[model samples]
Target: IYTGVYADGVNQANRRKSRHEQSFVAPEWGWAWPMNRRILYNRASADPEGRPWSERKAYVWWDADAQQWTGEDVPDFEKTKPPSYRAPAGADGVEAIEGIDPFIMQGDGKGALYAPQGLVDGPMPTHYEPVESPFRNQLYGQQANPTRVEYRRDDNPMNPAPPEEHVDVFPFVFTTSRLTEHHTAGGMSRYLEHLAELQPEMFVEVSPALAAERGLEHMGWCHVVTARSVVEGRVLVTERLRPLKVEGRTVHQVWMPYHWGSGGLVKGDSANDLFGITLDPNVLIQESKVGTCDVQPGRRPTGAAMRQYVEEYTSRAGVTDAEYPPIVTVSDDIVTASEDTGTQEEEDDE
Candidate 1:
């Protein structure tokens, strides 16, 4: 494993573990599979036909004097082979690869702009409205990933899908992400007292409009609810979160940081726990980054009362996958049209 190997919580067997799947290796080196190497697709630096793209970032280049292929990075081709040599279509090894095949990791060695295989869902990335989405799906008919995982345990209850039509009682969407000041999940940052003091308590940042609507004063206690969980934090009313205008509908967003899990020194309720196990199919990454939730003023119930609050929220906002979220559209046609015109003008000058 290279750098950035993180202990991403427990496994299915409840064992504490870590993963570093990004490492790659060179052929003839000591290591093998079951352990990924550092340079799995080093061949991609070259163009399709085994020609180097640029002399500077070149992994391999032809040496006219030596009449052989040479490179600074590991050579994706046979060491002594010349660029002019061609292997037949059915031939194995490097010869069978077309000049356009850049990513050598796959058997075919081609760069797939649109992946035909390997991904669980369709290969290309498509935006889906979150399971607890406030807006309509904009990408054709596809809503969220149909295969989104739902953990049936009592600890994780999901919201009902549309058509069944759940109530939008706590009518706001919230996203929990990392702040630059803290590391991913806050396990490391909570260990330090100075860092803990700076962000002393778990806080939920809300827009001033939402705060006023809910009768929440600045720095007051606020309760955020989702289908799965209810988390309480100090309110931080800010203007940074304005209502976004999308497709003639107003969409408001709340930003929360998911740093305070259990076992940390300055720990509080985990923001990640509020999200059900909905994930993006292509990368198998949790869609904990975005979800739907409702916020209200005042402190959350403690002990048994807290559990009731979560159950009540789940009963109201039944879970289901729905449409894709709206996106801002930008046209690249003008840029493409200018490219051909600029090339013709340059050629005329010559």
Candidate 2:
């Protein structure tokens, strides 16, 4: 009851003895996951010679003379087996497990640093920009994740091109999260009056600085857009959501809870409608949890006007169909975009 690790009370082998020796005396041994193993890799508690590291920190140890396992808990190692014991060549099953090695599940009975196989992409990880990003890769020439499973269906469209080639129209960084009062997608929590009352409606959290620039009113209606879709929610101007000064530019961000959906009792637009299908390479999990978007004050355009709204932004921002950045690096100096523009204009005038 004290520790949530075990279903029942710990071992009560001896009233005067420590808790370690009482593991078996419980109403039942660990009834939790991983076969009730109180502690994983218990064999490591003992040295390679099968003796405890210190008298005070003694745990699982192999009793050589008695030829048995003795400890405060069940030993994760083979009973009566000494650390000197090594499996013979061509040994199978448990016989193949070396007495000195604690991690038996591994192929070599050791931890892996570089994976030899099983990974679809390269074994090592590299930095790649997301499917939608306002900046290019600062370290390498790789603009976006080459291995990501990108999709462009009729239902699921894409956003702007790589940062170096095309200027992104969706300037602000947008992401989705869940509120404490509501459950995921508002399936169970929205129907409950108690939970629904806390968060009465869907809203977007914006920095007070961004709110001033966009002229958004507190608790006023605001629309967010992407190449895929547009969604509207109430504006929540808060100081907590502040702008980030990245590369000498004040980059604003939009945050919204994804709990609301059309099916809920408090029906509202789903934040998921903003982006199309883009998935992690190994797991194939969609990046719907977060993506980039554009925000505007007032309600979203309807019918034919919506298409025109998107097309106009695309034309203004020059959304090219370039898959990757043409030039690897933008400039030699570590200057801001504002300074770079100033220098370019001076050169043009000269």
Candidate 3:
């Protein structure tokens, strides 16, 4: 389906003409041009009296002598409406819009922290575990988010958590992010040698503590395990990641650059491959930023055999693909106990 909504006509002049016209279009088809300008409802910058918020930010104001509206910037008005006009209560259509409100596109007249209408799941942002998770929710009684998605396929198996255990065998939480030099998934980087050399291959970074625990050396391969999948990458051990004491337990984290999709010169499985398409309730952004996995020092098994390798870890964890990190506890004492124990031990041994 398509809707013919072109915000820009032939030129800037024509674009301005169309701006004064009311238009609606479907999501599938629309165009903004001459810079793809998209301004929020600019009219609300003015008070009901038609004066702008400030001279620097001034856009429009009422002209009492001329009995019309005037503005140095884009005049967001009917071109002649006076400032004294009052809207009746419960008025329908444009009149119902409060004079100070700008986001008329939304149902309500405010910049809502909780959007009651647009989003499907809910309005506020809630932290949920990704499909592949290593840690349960430390902030909530529920371990992984109850709403996280799980795929039953061979490519996507979910790891499970034991009872009351927020941390799992895949002890380190892993997240994939982009490198500034490489675009997302690394399509452009593949064609360019300079970018490829800078980040030649798929690598996962771990803290020195995790590297030592796993017997992984810098630039050596480390097998990252989750119930559904396994991928091996070169290791970069650094001090940047220290164990975080969450809920009285020391939690480790790992980092991976997700720019190595299959099409690149440095080809690898999509970091997104490990991610199931669960979305944030407010903005519908995929919950791909954080997840759980175990790390081991070794080359990962290849081809069909890799699946078997991951399955072995899942079996040892004694949980099914549907389960994840156990429920979170709300006690500050429980959360901080791990750190406290370490400190007390240090003091007592002294």
lDDT of 2 by residue, 230-316 (tens): 889999999888899877788898999988887656878888877677787778998555566778899888889987887676555
TM-scores for all candidates? 0.64, 0.66, 0.63
lDDT per residue (tens digit) for residues 127-191 in model 3: 65454554555555444455444334544544554333433666778788888779877888866
- lDDT rank order: 2, 1, 3
Residues forming the 10-long window of minimal summed lDDT in candidate 2: 320-329
**Residue 110, candidate 2: how far off, in angstroms?**
5.0
Which pairs clash (backbone N, Cα, C closer than 3 Å) in model 2?
11-22
274: Cα error in model 1, Å: 0.8
Q: After aligning candidate 2 to the native by TM-score, how far in Å is the CA of 304 from where it should be?
A: 4.0
lDDT per residue as tens, model 1, 68-174: 55555455545555545556768886667644454546667666668778877667767766666665567644456665654455555555433235635646778
Cα RMSD of all models vs. native, in order, equals: 12.9, 10.6, 11.7
Measured by lDDT, the strongest candidate is 2
lDDT values for all models: 0.65, 0.73, 0.64
Backbone clash count, each prediction separately = 21, 1, 7
- How well does model 1 score by local distance difference test? 0.65
> 133 in model 2: Cα distance from truth in Å?
0.7
